[model samples]
Target: MRPRLLFASAAAVVAALTAATAPSATGAPRAAAAAWDSDLAAAALSANPAAATASGSQSPELGPGAAFDGNGATRWSSNAADNAWLRVDLGETLRIDRVTLDWEAAYGKKYVLEVSGDGTNWRPFYTEDAGTGGTVTAHTYPQEVRGRYVRLRGIERGTPYGYSLFSFKIYGGTPAPASTTRANLALHHP
Candidate 1:
């Protein structure tokens, strides 16, 4: 049974890889090749509700949820402090491939992206020592990371104000189908 489960997992991974690399009938790669190219982060996941929070909000309208609300006009602004941070809970563990920070005029000059399973202990996977203030900035890791909580900690501010973000997005985790997880569980428990 254990061997069968292992084989099933391996087969699924191989199938996904094959599908990602297979060419079209015209003998040309698919236009969305980046979707399957693990080297590039090509997909974006919707921000989970009630999963965002900040260390300190500058105003009620500029709360943490505003950044995840899909509106560029709304933003989350923290108090004027270098230790400001914002976090998002993904609800469950996911294979995070990339993170995008849509910044306003205020941004973090130095920040670290940390991930954790229980939200208590975090592991910093990516760090921007010199972040440039811009409308949009993206970071892709060399390999995917599994975590339920993602946090951005500001070490330095680009402006006199605290960190401000119009939106924070995470990409690249495809959850297994319900049937698949059930089958895998049966195989291991039977």
Candidate 2:
């Protein structure tokens, strides 16, 4: 009876350790799920032209606008380079929650999602080193991240072609007006 009790205790300890170190369904560390919030970023504006700049576009029609046009059939393709990237401006500082990327056949296998208040400074929000191609990927933040700009920096392309996106969606947070006028305040208050 004493030996049985000791064996049971050891078994429980091994189980606990295995569970603690297990990988999640997404093939990411269990801790990665804790860093993500399930909320979507639909309220965001594309803000690509005024707030965004890219490494390069394949053509005018296939430029950044194609990715934000809300049509899944059209896409934006970049020049065949590992360093190509696309950015979107939220116009004002917002609590960013999620980002969805609809990839074309030409996708990014290694990339980083970053945020910035000023276009020049950037901080990584998420990273995917073994990304699968031709899929819609959504990344959510566990906590609110305040920023004006979001960028997808491609480090490795999945195909001989450059990185291509069918649609890029940013969601979450309220859009802050640059300045509020007295009339606007009165209208809401009244």
Evaluate all candidate structures by whole-model CA lDDT and list the values in order. 0.74, 0.71
- Score every model by TM-score: 0.67, 0.65
What TM-score does prediction 1 earn? 0.67
lDDT of 2 by residue, 1-190 (tens): 2322112344664575477568878878653111123322222333234444578998877887667667788888999999999987766666666778989889999999898999889988888999987665554646567787888999999888999998887766644343333333332211
Pairs in steric clash, model 1: none
Error of 1 at 133 (Å): 1.3
Per-residue lDDT tens digits for candidate 1, residues 1-190, read 3443433566775676587678878899753323322322112224345688789999988988877776778889999999999988876677777777889989999999898999999988888888887754445556568788888999999999989998877765654557456454345433
How big is the positional error of residue 11 in model 2, measured in Å on the Cα after superposition? 58
Worst 10 residues of 1 by lDDT: 36-45
lDDT of 1 at 72: 72
**Number of backbone collisions per candidate:** 0, 4
